[model samples]
Target: MKALNATLPTQGLLNFKNLVYLDLSFSTLHNNFLKDIGKISSLKILLLSGCQLSGTIPAAKGLCELKHLLKLDMSNNDLRGTLPSCLANLTSLQQLDISSNHFIGNISISPLGTLTSLHKLQLSRNLFKIPISLLPFFNHSKLKFLDCHENEIYADIDVPNLTPKFQLETLDLSGQGDGGVFPKFLDYQHKLEYVDLSDIKMKGEFPHWLIGNNTKLYTLHLPSCSLSGPLHLPMHSHVYLSHLDISDNSFNSPIPTEIGVQFPNLYFLNLSGNGLIGDIPSSFGKMSQLIKLDLSNNRLSGIIPQDLIVGCISLFNLILSNNNLQGQIFPEQANCKELDRLLLDGNQFTGSIPYSILNCTLLNMLDVSDNHLFGSIPGWIRNMTFLRVLDISENKFSGTLPSNFVPPQIREVYLSNNRLQGPLTNAFYNCSELMTLDLSRNYFTRRIPDWFGKFPKLSYLLLGYNNLVGEIPIQLCNLGQLSLVDLSNNNLSGHVLPCITAASNKVRQEEVGTNPYMASSPAYMKQPLEFTTKSISYYFQGSILKYISGLDLSCNNLTV
Candidate 1:
């Protein structure tokens, strides 16, 4: 006793009369202090975790004075110790956290069976590889939360035996590295609210009992666990489910159209990278509170429902690209006031671009390319001041270039492969924020806009296959940031607009300016003339259809 008192710091020993909590954690104390701690008879909580303390817990013959100790958190310390059989004497301990420590020894079951008052046990982040042997004592117990994650232990999940722990609500057995079919281990987890069994090797289809109607669970994340097969619809509807992510699995089958009805409270549903197919259920619009819906990279088909935008008013992200959908976009922005992103490319939709999209005040991205749309673009589309990206290329659009057609906020514009006509509108020069402008395959005529060099951010401009005459504006040659320019096959004269060649450092030349009619004169005529006969290729067949095949500006008195 005298030697123990000498090792104690000179200023350390304080009054033990009213000491209800003593936390000497991370203090690097040795086993010598374990036997001497018996002197503090009034301690109710002892936290000596991560203290570099090695050696097994001393024999419990002399430490019975701590009868009132209720909490002991000896976690994350160098306590290379064994489960002392004497822990059975600490019957009054209710909370124990011995995780993340070097505890090397067999976890004998006989000693822990008597700890009936234990309510919370955290033995995770350790090297304990023994199969869970506390199955016998858990019957009709008071354990509430058990976290054995990231441990080397292996054990078959026995759910029926754990059904009686009326207080048990959260069970985390993730990162155990186990393999086998996930036992139908949750038949009676009536009170379970959160279950995370991710990254553990659980084969076979996911058991339906984990998220059925009778279950009161709210969060179930079972990711990357070798679970396959189409997820069978749970017989019981999960009305309270809010967050569900079953990504990176082999679950094939069309997502049940009744999903919205089954999980009405679902807010985030991420089924990406799966083999799911079929059209998005219009019923999903019923989830009024859903915020994010990602159905990308699936075999989904059918036109996206306009009701989905109207119903999910709070949806911020909607990704439905890379699918086999075919239909014109339903033009309605009144219901999608908060729609920020709308990615609907790689589909076949016909008809003119809808003018109602201007109402989407918060729209940041709009990708409707690779469709079959026609007619002049509504002027209201360029008025979307907040739009950053606008891609309407690969469609059949015509008419004179609308003034103020480019938004100042637009960074990228891909209007390629369209039948747009008339001279370059001066409004485009005002789009100082433009970065990429691809208007190839259009019928733009006359000299290029003189203010093109004023754009500080213009880097790529592709205007191939146009009947643009006079000369490439000298202002365009002064654009230092212009990296790629394509003006091939045009009737451009005036010394070929110096520095406008394939050898130009920042320019690329390609064949352009195909004529729909066989005429001697170049297109872009300022004077209106009556056509005696249609061109061989019929450029003037439709309503003011002079510009065709990128740009059919032939048979007109246009000079350089």
Candidate 2:
């Protein structure tokens, strides 16, 4: 039972003498709900996940007395303290899940060592300090799945190379363990299908042998692992491999040319934030099933392969920013109909924005800033009804913005440092959901629009370094959510509105879950919003952006 706000009486539960299964997940229950639960000795499965339970597990007679229990799940709760030692009495337990809790203590001294019948165990996101060697479970021959990520687990160099009896199918110890070498026991784990060792400080070259050994492996994540050298793939193709991420590592070589052939069925691939160079392999065009591809923040050169753009028809999110890649954005034959977010900022690309991207009508975010592209801003951009963020700043684009430029659902628009010149249009007047609007360092000439106050959710307003001349409008004070305002380098003449100052002081609260265009990964919104203060430019994004509050009226003709 879930969301049954009513309190469960301990006496009423005791009446079920033959209750084999009982699930009280996501239910509000009394603190002493489990006080008399052990009396029902026939309980085989007990699930109390997301119950908001707190404090330590009850006494021995409460839960440990359920010797017949085969499955126990108390995950997604506020429960803390050490696991009861008496839990070993439940010898029949096949599955035990206590993840996402505050439970502490060493796994070796816990009751898990004695639970030989366990087939699966989840202890992730806790305070447990388990040994990286996994010596405690060496005798568990039947165990197939074990997840203990995001804990205080550390490496013990002195531990011996005792082979584990069980061959795991899925093992996730990411975001745990101390700085050391890769786990030696994995050398014998040939049955592994999914493995994640991300955020663990294991300095070494990529383990090419691991993929050769575990041919069934489908998902392998080793990001931020201090890994060095070239990313080497096994000589033989791995047909089952799908998701592979080795980002934020020190891999300093060109990507393997046959990567697409080795893993042709890959659905998601991320190799960003490395020192990899050379051109993106044309073999990537072979992976027709690829959906999300990220190769950003690398030293990769050469133009984006035309075949990869046209071949990957199922692509959704493509990120190739901050690279040395040059040439036009995409080939005229490019047709990625399912593309949602595309980031090509901080590159050496030339030529105007291509019309080939029009096939991606489902676009949500498009960023091509800090490039050498030059042309008139396209008016067809307004046709992207699902678009939320549009960043075309720091380019050579010249000419007036399209009369109907604003998208209906646009939230953030960045058109700064361009050669565009004209009066500010009323295209954004109906954009009530707009949050950020930047038009700085342009040749636009006109009075600050009073209609800007009509946007109920607008937070940042940047219109600095323009030829506009007029009095600062007091109507700006109507924006209750306004956090940062910049009208600097203008010819405005007027007294500063005290109401605008007061509104800036108010803390800007972010509407977290209300975003309709939220991407599946945080990489989609990695570009920061730039604002100058005290003669220094500051970049803000994510959580830090909400805390920033300031006003810039410098280099202007404003009066006291």
Candidate 3:
């Protein structure tokens, strides 16, 4: 619903005097809001979100006149200036969301509390800075939801004395939890259901009292909260918690085998980035409703039980990378028909790719790299019609490429650092979606495939440290999206293409516009970009690789 760039004609709405609800959200409307907008006396719901509304709400006298307003959403606009003092006059305003704007100044939380009817208030992602004392002013008995996340609201609270009167259903303080500790006051609110205290810098045991004390909660996020000790879930607490994240903490404990029994209804669970050891609890299979489970970057070992997640048929993403987990990939996971993202890389897992995994046809991202896995590449991998990102690199797999080794939907292929001896195959030449191909440090012997230059989205072509012998294929110059090219330590000989040499010196204008879309994220994320800088193979990961493009052709028998 796009509006004219010119000022909104409040007079135009004057004719709709009986209008009870006016929603012009995402209308792309521009210019200062008209004070005359207050004329819409009957407006109970006014949503101008994403309308590109700009400038100050200096005199919202017209809006203030809407004493009957029940909901007003003006978020995702360019509105600035202090909220109008007249706003406190909307005694009937139940839900007021003015987040994600440029609004600034000391916003007094006390004035809004006058509208005792106010149940939800969202002030996140704005530049409002004020006293932590103003928090108490939000003690409105009816207020149930308050989100002041990602703001500069400082802390100066009397935690012990302040008992919130409202029974909050959702409270997301996360980065804005002013005080470095969990607000002990929350311990008094038994009605709190959704709570996010992430990055609060809390120490010691997990805040079991929070959940143990509350009746129930739907989501609890405590990532980077600096809490440590064994994670123990109260069996009687949180029977309805659907989402839980405690990543990036110092948790050191065996994931309780009773986790699934306790969180039978959990849909999302992440316990990554800790010192959790022992096998992934087989009891986790009891969480039949589990959708996403991330236990990556831990010290966990032991074989993942094939039936560990066989019951979680709804599971879509299972990430267990960077752990000490061993044993063969479980075929029981094939029962999860919705599986799309599977990351078991950087672990100690061994054995050939499970043939049964091909049973999960919905698989899009599969990573088994940096493991002890061995055996010939599975030909059935092509049966996964939707497979996109395949990383089986850094292993001892010895075999030649299957006729159709590359999945048609593949965006990135990481088969590097393996004992796989093979010649370049044209079977994957037509995989138009192929972007990053790293078969480096292998025994692959053959002239560089000219098809490398034809891959429309190919960004990083790393075939370095191979036994390949011959001139560098001039067809490589045809890759308009080529960024990082590694051909070092090869037995190839050639007069380098000027186009390929210019790549390391300056980004081809076409290449710059093609990279971001080359490899869809997660798979592209954290994938190392290895290139020789001053004769040293430097690795760039994460967002830094976006700007670091190079070409490594040294140590090759080839002459440029």
In candidate 3, the residue pairs with backbone N, CA or C atoms under 3 Å apart (3 or more residues apart, or in different chains) clash, namely 1-27, 38-62, 38-63, 493-558
Give the poorly placed runs of model 1, Cα more than 4 Å off. Answer: 1-17, 22-140, 147-167, 173-178, 213-215, 331-334, 345-353, 367-379, 388-560
TM-score of 2: 0.90
Better candidate number, 1 or 2, judged by TM-score: 2
lDDT of 3 at 340: 90
**Positional deviation of residue 345's Cα in model 2 after best superposition, in angstroms:** 0.8
List, residue by residue over 407-451, the lDDT tens digit for candidate 1: 776777778778888887675757877756777778877777788
Residue 273 of model 2, lDDT score: 96
Which parts of model 2 are misplaced by more than 4 Å?
A: 2-7, 15-18, 27-36, 58-60, 425-432, 449-456, 473-481, 494-502, 505-527
| C-alpha local distance difference test of each model | 0.66, 0.86, 0.78
For every candidate, C-alpha RMSD to the true structure in Å: 14.1, 3.2, 3.5
| lDDT, candidate 3, at 515 | 45
- Tens-digit per-residue lDDT, 448-495, candidate 2: 878888887787888988988888877787887787888888888888
Kindly list the per-residue Cα lDDT of model 3 for residues 1-560, writing each as its tens digit: 46556556555677788999888887755463546667778889999888887888756576778888999998998888777777888988889998999988765543564767878989888887744433554457888888877767555544446666778888876674445455556667788789887766654677777777776788989898778889887857357789999999887889988888878889999999978988888888888889999999999998887765578889999999999988887654458788999989999888898877877789988899889999899878878889888888889999788877767877778888889887977757768878778888899988877777778778788888889988888787778777788888889886878888887777544443454664354434567756776767788777666676788888877655
Better of 1 and 3 by TM-score: 3
